[model samples]
Target: MECFRIDESGYTGFDLLNRDQRFQGATAIAIDDEEAARLIREYFPRLQAGELKYRALSRRPGNHPRLLALLAELLRAHKSVTYVCDKRFLLILMFCDYAVEPYYYERGCNFYEDGQNYGMASLLATAGPTLLGKSEFEAMLAAFQRATKEKTPAALKDLVRAAQKTKWRELPEAIGPLAQYAAPECLSAIATEGVTTDAALVVLQSLITRMEVMSDGPYRVEHDQSKNLATYHDLLCRFIGHEEEIELRQSEIASFKFPLKLTEVVQVDSKASPAVQLADVMIGAALEAANVMTGLRADGLDPEKLMPLYAEDQFIHLIPSVDFAEQKQFRRGTQAAEVIDYFAANFGPKK
Candidate 1:
């Protein structure tokens, strides 16, 4: 049976719509046991002190080349699928103002009141960088700080409800009328069944697309573990018709008699799985690369700074060019296709 490991960057829950939201990404790598061992052995000594995986290590200057090389190796040596989201674009996709059933509105508002919505985190994260020295964002930043401290669902609803009532600071002249959206309601809709469905689309579509590209198998998916992502895991299990708890190992799935063609999903400690750690590394660079791929960083930063990370001889050379490879020919499922259409209609990132 084939195996794959998955890892993620950034939070996807209530944090997904914050003004200071980092890029949210997921990476899948198909690596065999032998190669996984080999990577662990080869990169172990070279890893910096206190570096657990890509997240901590990649933040430092000296480690950039190492991560680039690791990604290059994965690209060359294995089948991989990576998706890094511009959560800002995603928010627009989510709240595009489509008509909804009265129940859908209630669901959205209930999720908001229940503190289950993540749209605000994503929105703040999206807007924070640009308004760095601005006043209105500073006010929102303060509000965000305060909001983050609200632990109860009722407290969250109070915060969300406070949006229009609270007098917000003036926007930076440069931001223009777009800043009018500073209202709390504008940041995130209390998610409804319709909204949650839209929010889940990208994640589900990305995974389904990767599965299609990789072909059907009794494949097992091992992902990095997180407590906040319990629902996300349940969503995957629901899709595959697998109702078991996260087992963290392939042997556990095999013993349960689940079919190999259908994916068996589990979440494990990244420390226990080298491939999951490598997926972390790949996603770190990919997030910056995504900023370049999309127009987010276009006028703001020199994205070429990322070029050397995948420089020809250093790492990019190791990844196969495969100009005509049909390896990516697999098709998206219905929901995924619908999401793809929605994304394309919005500002989908360049591949």
Candidate 2:
């Protein structure tokens, strides 16, 4: 595994491969179209310059090489705003998406390719705490409400118990007061300790199912082939409580308003809190999961290959063929480089 170099545009020499050049979770090249062409032509020379390193430091075994390699390439492509903060940065980056989801631990490291694995959330703890699954978290909150009605222990709560204890049939009333009850320690306990109460357990299972649904976004993975569908149907039957025959009603799935053209990609914040963002990330990876899923469905392509993008991970991935780079190049109205210089001039560096 040697280092690779690409002297595109004016970005020549090892500076092209400088650590600073790789931001967030992507590899940035310093070159225009002509330089890009030349580097692509002599790509082997760059490989000879840098190493494709993998340093796995988890308590469990390392990830599969094929899966790990693909993830690495994905990280490189999307690393622009994504940063790695640990010793095994590359290895950890590959696992970040999976690590954030619920039940990841039960499935081991190789669960992304197949959406049927049941315990992806649990498996990720081996890596570290990064994401929180939203739908699952909501389901858990529901259970917490139920538990309050049943007068269960206070510890088995999501921090929103005051409102949750009310007799309101709708969830929002019960959830508001209990928002503060969501302690990290309590969540850690829940993740590590499987539920004893039936209500709580069902909520956990619901979280897992919701993750699959949300993850099926445009460019993200859609593991619903006929075979996968049966498993999915069974899970839905279990999650929804009772098996009313379901069918894909294309007309019923109304179109959403597009902030940008079909040919354009826009980034929208869900306005979710850090905890909520973590929950969504664990459920579907990042905002990119939603974006890719939308993009893929807009066109006609199977999206099972697109990986989930976690928010904390901080990179918005793009397919090389997409026009995102062009949009970035023409982003004159937004807070771009001039803003950075202005900030630097005002405050100075924090050395």
Candidate 3:
């Protein structure tokens, strides 16, 4: 009897190479229909009449205090989960796709290689054509050829050259359907849109897992409809596994823990959906907190103070990786820096 509505924001580009692109994220607010109606009735009057957006309602100087109050209320509630990403970490999934492959298992994270040799270029070279198609794929490889004539980290020059020559005859039967469906635009979105779509999937996976322990019976999910996002979400759900039942070895997410069974997924406009609107606000606040601390050179806000503004032990997780960073030990000062510093020192250095 639980319904979760999804919303997202702060994505301007899907190109993985655009490191300067702003933070991208998605949020979901879970509630029953009655609760959704109650929330909309109580808050809609106070919000700007058009759309209850975080950027409009929270960012304007005049609205800052109201925005803060909204964020405070979001923290007080336990129904929301957010995934806000660092651009660099998301780009590195491409690298992960390479390092973890069968051909490169030996080069995967190890004592000496430390996973540096696995760059996104390898993944793109191998799989980019499946998404980007021949012409665009060739153009992308041409760009790589220019930047990395002699010094490509993952030794992607061979793959890039191969990708330029990729043909239907070369592609495996596994990729036939994708090759048939993928167009230039969809391929282009795989980067920027992938961040939000992937994060949303994680949220769905985690939330459903939590729901299994807290409730019983069926669940319904609603999302403010964006065609690309909806496409990604639905695709993951159908192909990956059931919300409640997943094969142990084949599971994309390791910690299944039995998410509440999802009976349906609905797509609706945000203007018509209270849960989606509220999810938008929460997602906005979460991404904004990260942006305030790490983005906006002028803000220079304290990262530690950011967590307490929400409910005790509940707050936005500004993660720099595909996997969520466990922040229970997130203390102020040096410790806060260390969370990211550890990844920076070990994983791909910032940018």
**Top candidate by TM-score:** 3
lDDT of 2 by residue, 1-351 (tens): 111111011111111112322211212111133332332234223332122222211111332333334333434442112211111122222222212222333335332322211122222223122223434343443453344234345634433443233332332211222343343433442333222221112222222322323222321111112331233333333333322332221111111121111121112222311211212222222222333354522321123543432233333232111233444333323321222223223222123
Worst 10 residues of 1 by lDDT: 247-256
lDDT by residue (tens digit), candidate 3, 119-232:
233344456567557575555433433323333424343433433444633442222222343322223222221222133433344444444433456666777777646643
Cα miss at 269, model 3 (Å)?
Answer: 1.8
Q: What TM-score, to 2 decimals, does candidate 1 have?
A: 0.55
Q: lDDT by residue for model 1 over 158-182, one digit each (tens)?
A: 4444332323232222122123333
Question: What TM-score would candidate 3 get against the native?
Answer: 0.57
Alpha-carbon shift of residue 87 in model 3 (angstroms): 2.8
Q: What is the lDDT of candidate 1?
A: 0.46
Alpha-carbon runs more than 4 Å astray in model 2: 1-16, 19-54, 58-306, 309-314, 317-332, 347-351
All candidates in order of TM-score, best leading: 3, 1, 2
Q: Model 1 Cα displacement at 240 (Å)?
A: 0.5
lDDT of each: 0.46, 0.26, 0.46
